[model samples]
Target: MSPNPWWQDRVVYQIYPRSFCDSDGDGIGDLRGITSKLDHLQALGVGVVWLSPIYRSPNDDNGYDISDYREIMPEFGTMADFDEMLAAMHARGLRLVMDLVVNHSSDEHPWFQAARTSRDHPLHDHYIWREPGPDGAPPTNWEAAFNGSAWEWNEPTGEYYLHMFSRKQPDLNWENPALRQEIWALMRFWLDKGVDGFRMDVINMISKPWRADGSLPDAPVVREGFLQPAFAMVCNGPRLGEFLQEMRREVLDHHDTLTVGEAPLATIAQGIELTHARGGALDMLFQFEHMDLDSVGGHVNGKWALKPLDLRDLKQTMNRWQQALHGQGWNSLYLSNHDQPRPVSRFGDDGRWRVESAKMLATWLHLHQGTPYVYQGEELGMGNVAFDDIHDYRDIETLNHHRVATTERGQDPAEVMASIHAKGRDNARTPMPWSAGPKAGFTTGEPWLRLHPDHDSVNAQRARADPDSVFHHYRRLIELRRQHPIIVHGRFDLVLAEHPLIYAWTRTLGDERWLVACNFSGDTPVFECPAELAGREARLVIGNLRAGAGERVDDLQALVLRPWEAVVLRLLD
Candidate 1:
């Protein structure tokens, strides 16, 4: 048997620091606030904590537009506070993973400032700069992820700089060897500080592809505004593997750490090459294929417009990834994060059956053959917020999209607001509810953003007090993974693949097999054992509902499942 890496079986919990907890009673959460919550995470059975960006920033993109890579954001805390937090996490046997956002930097960063000062400056080539077109417009029709043109003019330098997200964030030029070395040194700085790993933001977009003549080309127009989809040229470029392997050799080989790259447009073949043990590229990748299930018109439509999710598409996408990387690579499983809306609101029912649906979603994701990630408030089954007014929104991307849709595209404001309410990132940015207090027990002062109105009934304190709460259900699921080797190493086989309301699968290891069945809808359904599983004796392991003595199955048979119910059973010969 091969040696097991520390991360293979570990459950990772992601904390959006700005909304996790507030220590100084201020409106924002800080490193010290996270330190205070270590016990909560430990009790939840999480072995690793993956924090979103906490680096110094101008708040243009909520910490993604980093101004200083080595300094902590003043709003969060001082450098000493970060050190103290790291020490506290270590003492509690929890590893820390920092966000690495080297794809771009804040315009206020010294390098970008110098680059903008003059074309003769030594750092002028540090970022992607190009002269305006002969028509005095942008060099290309490439559209930004946030709605406008990707290129922003710098008056002083008489050149346009590329920004994939926001104008305040200027994309770096990875073609420069000096910049690569600088990034490697920065990685070394964090490793020396004892960080266990990095979650690289848009890491796959570092290596951009240029034309054979060394000139940038215009992308194919996909929208009415000549908004070309630039991701095709920007993501998983030709030299991405080369750059990742080089970084691994120069910086990562020296430290015993984990690295997961956020590759938005990467394919399964690319994922295999990036994470295969012998590939020397990365440990794993967060692919977005499954996340785009509700997206229409492919990548051009983005996530604003929603479509009814097809269960067949979902199953095929997941099964492909699991089977492709069964032995050669690893997978990172997640349902929601800072960039997504609440899973219960987007995927499961958040109304009358919130608790039951949340538990079912957790069971479905955690039982998959991969390392599981639990976002903040996920264990408590927090639902999405319903902000009626546009002024209540704080996310830059949401605001930009609203403006572009209503003002430029002539879309109705009410219709745009409806989409925003359903899929906006702000839904996930609300302050975490620790208790049923005035401000959700997140801050003594007014929160930076509004708290969810339903926090009174769905807070962490309330869940911990109830033995049958969603929090306890998640804890039990985590514990099950640790106790059963089949869950971590067994081969996966999809069962009831075409079922519209039920998701069922089985994991087999040597002579033992575990069967998992989940009902996703609010209606009761009868689930029949598959032909291969017929005539096999089974023992109930864990489930959301109690199995009475009269209802227990002594032989292979069909079972009536309640709304949003999930069950795990062990097959005994």
Candidate 2:
């Protein structure tokens, strides 16, 4: 069998610099801290480490709003530290994927600072700007991703600057040819520094495709304030492909680097086209459809309310993306990230069966035909942290949503606060539970962020000793994927013959075929398969339970799948 694509077969581990580990006893994780944990990550069987932004930032968005593209954040480390970290990672046979936040820069960035100096400044045109209305309000009805108007009033320029996110982050004017070339040069700078690739943050938001009159694309459902005409006008603009191609030629094409874009508003077709490995712009793009399952109403553009995800919709969405992007682009499979809450609390029964359900989720994601990414603390089955008050939140997005859900949306403040508690970045931002000691051994001093109260009980040390813990299960799952080529490069066909709760799929390559059946419900679900479909006897490859190999004594028989149980069986001739 042909070896799979490098990234398709590899697993990535995400590191949030602030919470990873602190070497200086400063209560914040840094480059040295990450280097120290490289062994831990290597032991986890992860081929790559996807780091959150360590670029110089004002920390308004915790490094998302970048102030410098070249330098490391002082709090994280210096140039020397970054160099050493990269070298150390390479030495350990681990690839490093740096976070790229080029769509917008912090207002404090030299370019933006110069632009704000005077309207006649050469850099003044680097960012999108427009005159405000007679009411001294924003230029448009567009909303910021962090809340409030997308346009931020600039007193110096006497114009409102556009920021798709926070006011501190002004969107760059990619329409300028000079700006595009400059950004391309910056990308090469990192590649030259021995970095593997980039995780482009909000890469889709770089373009501005606004018409002269600022009218959005005249579509019937294209309402105001959601996806402005400017968004389409800007995103994937006139020269997006060209710029990406140039970057590929100069930066990515030469090296075995990976580029995964945080494409939020892109459709499945658009995502596939943009990430085609043959000649596409990026290596992969994350689709938010599955992540948005908890969103209420069909209106995908407004303040979201938590809703139960139907098994049918969830299975269908995953199947669609897997099938459509088969040969074109790859997939970046993840259930949790810094922007999301812990998956166990949100999806699994964290209260009763945390480890079993966590393993179930891991099997469900890792066995799929895509590269799996494990966020920090995910392997240990971390759950959501409790936040008694709004002041406990440090994320700009959560704070902004709190305002909209309460004041503008006229919802009860208590309910809004409760939702934030249930679905907040702070949940994921809590310190990693390294041990059972105070502060979970993350820091001797008070941590930059609070540790989860349950850290004492649920920690890495305890999980490491327990063979049946989620951590060990993850290790076994990764080994299974790495050892079997079919798991990575095989054809994925969803088995919808059974109930939606019984999410089963088959992967096959040549004579090698495997069936992965998962029961998502609490009650045991029987998965029925036809004798002809089985082709031959099937032996158990991996199961979340303690069942041994070749226990499959059935073709049209009942299989007892306990709560959140998953099984991967190898078809034997």
User: Which candidate leads in TM-score?
Assistant: 1
Which 10 residues in a row give candidate 1 its minimum summed lDDT? Answer: 547-556
Q: On residues 206-291, what C-alpha lDDT tens digit does candidate 2 reach at each position?
A: 76666778633332336453453234344556556766777677667777788888877577887777887667878888767788
- C-alpha lDDT of all candidate models, in order: 0.88, 0.81
Model 1 lDDT tens row, 256-350: 88789999988899988898877647888999888999877657778877787777778889988988887778888999999988999988999
Regions of candidate 1 where Cα sits further than 4 Å from its true position: 1-3, 222-228, 547-552
> How do all models score by TM-score?
0.97, 0.94
Task: Highest lDDT: give the candidate number.
Answer: 1
lDDT of 2 at 258: 81
Superposed Cα deviation of residue 124, candidate 2 (Å):
1.4
